[model samples]
Target: MAKDNRIQMLPAEWRASTTLSGVYALRMLGMFLVLPVLALYAAGLPGAADNKALVGLAMGMYGLTQALMQLPLGMASDRFGRKKVIYFGLIVFAAGSFMAAAADTLEMLVAARAVQGAGAVSAAVTALLADLTRDGVRTRAMSMVGLSIGLTFSVSLVLAPILTELVGVPGLFALTGVLTVISIGVVAWATPNPQISKLHEDAEAQPARMGEVLRDSRLLGYDFGIFALHASQMALFTALPFALVDLGWDKVQHWKVYLPATVIGLIAMVPLVIVGETRNKLKQVFLLGIACVAAAQIVLFAGLGSLWSIGLCLAVYFIGFNVLEASLPSMVSKTAPSDLKGTAMGVYNTMQSVGLFSGGAVGGLLFQHYGFSGVFGFCTALLLLWLLVAACAPAPQPVKNLGFAVPPAWQGRQEPLRQRLSAVAGIEAVRFSSDGQTVYIKALQEGFDQTAAEQIISGAN
Candidate 1:
């Protein structure tokens, strides 16, 4: 049979990817909806009126629990099955949301947020996505998930304040619980179960390889990058709403600023990302993003007393935030060893969760003592540090993963096949599954010679 080289996803693949992306997006939406208004809402609660630290903890408690449970829940999926784990996680998340909605005190809200984070089903969702898609199209499937997250975040920023005005923070939590329950239904009925659920190293983390992924200096740099990026984001939010209020904008009207800022930032992000990926100038683009974020913080620290000035500063910040958010995982994929990509992502995500926790906790403390200047100043310093770390790290090679089935005859001839494929132009590194069923290649993204590689695979050379 001739190979089907078309890049379009099969109908089933589309269904799987779309539904899974929806499930992931819903879960993320639940978290994001609170971010824009959580600090302000928490401030009004008992035991929080005088304690910005407690409010910050309420904002960040989710991250702390999420960081702790993310890997364990993912590993649980391996043992108990993906759907089972995902269902369990969604239920726990919904329970937490309800708990948060009913809470009357900041302390109770903090515990509820911790419960919310305990769901930690991101890895399982990704693993299930990997299970449902073919190797050739897995990257596209993954991109859908990433796109959903970005869109969810943007929508949340615009909607959170408006929603808070209508139903208040408790209503938001209750709504999240309702949406999460709906997501559970989507998982059971909409998402197709995979016929086989074995591990895919390119998509699922492996415990045995954790040390190797951790020790790589390049991966560590990207890890720190994600950490700083999210930390800065959480830290910024801890004080931004209050700042807007002080500047004479009602909390609900703040969306006017966010709407335009987010739109412009997204528009600006497109050209930079395209140039970076296609032109092989990713490092330069990345550093520029960090600089933009740092500059925004510096502006805030220098004092933006008017809504217009604050809005302009946010536009710059979002440009950097969106670019870094989109590019960091791609950089991680390029930097990690071909087979250890999953493990590297696992560690990278853990660091992100930790950053979220730290930022909220620390930002709140700083804001309580030193006000807006302290919060922005701390964020600026962190980003500058990350920029330096990223600068010293080696530039990432522009490569993408390609997987092909191992022919029966080639199963026992791993070394020879590796050498043959590695000799092919554009193919940089080759790795085989332990059972020799699949061969994964790290090939140049721009001009991978798929036909040549396929011909070699079929013994037609």
Candidate 2:
């Protein structure tokens, strides 16, 4: 095939990916909008006085429920329908947001947050996306989803402080509810319906593969890394707002610190990621990111009293945070068995939610007992342990997923097709759909003989 003849997304595929990305981003924006202001706002609620633990619970409660509901809701999408489950999840999320808006106490807020989290729709949305797009274009579609989440986080960091100042926490929660409701309409009208929705091993978790994914030590390491990353994030935010306030920055002005730190950190991350990918020094780059995060914690622990010093620390933290956040998933994909990728991601996402809850609960408890020292000390220690785990783990080789259209004659001849593809140089693993219409290959990033594979796929060999 000529270079320009490569498969590209059709108009329908483009519409599906973009609209679904929008739907996913809207839901995530609702969740992220509260991260910066939740702790400080919750502190003023009834039953929260001097009870930072309760405040933390209020802040992190959504993660616990989200973790518990993700798999079940995903499976429910299989049994029911994709759009139906998504609509249901959105309604539940909206209800919780409204409930949270009316909460008068920390306890009420925690319960409301849990309700908010029960609407886990990520897996279903992903599965639907896979259903709508051909395998060759799926990765591009998925990247859009990831990009939306990153953009949402950046927007939330800048907008949260200003929004909080204008309407207060209760009003923010109400606004989230409204946005979620609007997302339901997007799902109904804007999002395209899939012709067929079935279990897609590349996109949805499989029950039989659970043990295989869980037993992989390398995959487990990536899972732990994600857990640590998000836990540290939640813990840091649990105390950061108050720290800024004490440093003489008003709640509304906190964006000044976050906006610059996030922008600069993102700018700094580009070159490191480029070098890591282009030079094959991913492990080195990954470790450096870990060190940056740990160093930021140490800076905070040493008590940076000035706003500028704290801002610098935040910039350092975001640099590490963004790098790890971006690379960890890539590493997981490289490490996981091609067929079990979805299962591995399911487990990875679950651990992330668990980490969020743990960080908030523990950070609050630690801060209440030992002040900022305890919070930053815990974050520093966690990242150091993660760095050690990452250092000792096997380095990941660069690889990419390649999908081929299996000829109709190849149906019921899995063994032959598998053998032929497996014999191709640099093709590490081969998996086929149950119907045998598609073949997924894991191949080395370099030395993949695409022409040879294509010839075999086209029956011209």
Candidate 3:
């Protein structure tokens, strides 16, 4: 293949990836829009005033349900269909959002959040993306989904305070319900249903390979790190709003702090990501990110009473978060054997979702008794654990995930084809489906002989 022979999405793939990303973003928007303002609003609600712990549980409930359902929903997609699962999940999510909008009590809100989290379709969406796109363009398509979530978070931070001022928190939840309902229509009308769906090794998890990926020491390190990352995230927000209010910032003015911190954090994140990928310093970058997160917590602990200090701490946290979020998945792919990639990701995603719930639950309980400093102390401990584990983990070699077309005649010849590709010096791992129409590979990017691999595969046919 020529260096300039760029991989491109077909019109259908382009629409599908974009629309699915939008759908995912809608769901995330509902979740994120609540984060910045909910702590403030919940404090005024029933049960929340007497016991702030109720506020934490309400805040984190979605994550608990999301974690519990992610894998099962993904598996369900295989049995029923991707679109069917997605439509059902979206409906459930919308219903939950509306229920939340209607809730007058913290208990009611918590229940609604649980229902919202139950609509976990993340794995299903990834599987559908794999079904829709060829290997050459799949990563880009997936990145679009990830990027959508990050963008959604930023937009929600800005929009939430404005929305809350206009419609109130319940109104914001109602808007989430409405947007999600619209997104369901988008999923139906815009996303092309996959003709055939299977356990996509590159895109979705396989239960059979769980043991291998889970037992690996390095992958476990990343999993623990992600868990800590999200846990700290949920805990921080559980207390941040109150801390800001105490610092004399009004609820509506909260966006002023969040807007700049998020924008600049994302800006600072870009360069760190580049250095990690281009400079082959991923482990060092990962450690540095962990250190920043710890530093952010310490800053929060020390400066909760100061507006500028809180702003700076939030900015640092987001910068670290963006880098780790991008780096961890790539490292997981690089570390796992090709066939078990999805399984590894399945566990990783589970850890992330569960961390949200844990953070909310634990952060709330800690804050209720020990106050803001206690919450920060706990999060600081998590960051410390992540730092220790990440330090011992090996630096990842520079590897990239690549997809190739396999002809129908080669369907039964995976062993020979694997041997042929493995002989290519840069290829690290090769995996083909039972049907053998698509091949996924991890290879050293520096000297990968794409031309030779293409010719040999074409010659096979």
Top of the candidates by lDDT: 1
Overall lDDT per candidate, in order of appearance: 0.91, 0.88, 0.87
Residues 1-461, model 3: lDDT tens digits: 22224866789899889999999899999999989999788878886775778888988889989999999999999998998899899999999999999998888989999999999989888888888887678778888998999889888988999889999999999999999999988988888877777767877888877888878998888889889999999999999988888878889889999998889878988899899898899888889889989999987776576788888898888888878888898899888876677889999999999899999999999999999989999999999888988888789889987777786656778888889989887888888864577787778979888777877777742
TM-score for each prediction? 0.98, 0.97, 0.97
Residue pairs in clash, model 3: none
Candidate 2 versus the native: TM-score?
0.97
- Stretches of model 3 off by over 4 angstroms after superposition: 1-5
Against the true structure, candidate 2 has what lDDT?
0.88
Q: By descending lDDT, how would the candidates be arranged?
A: 1, 2, 3
Clashing pairs in 1: none
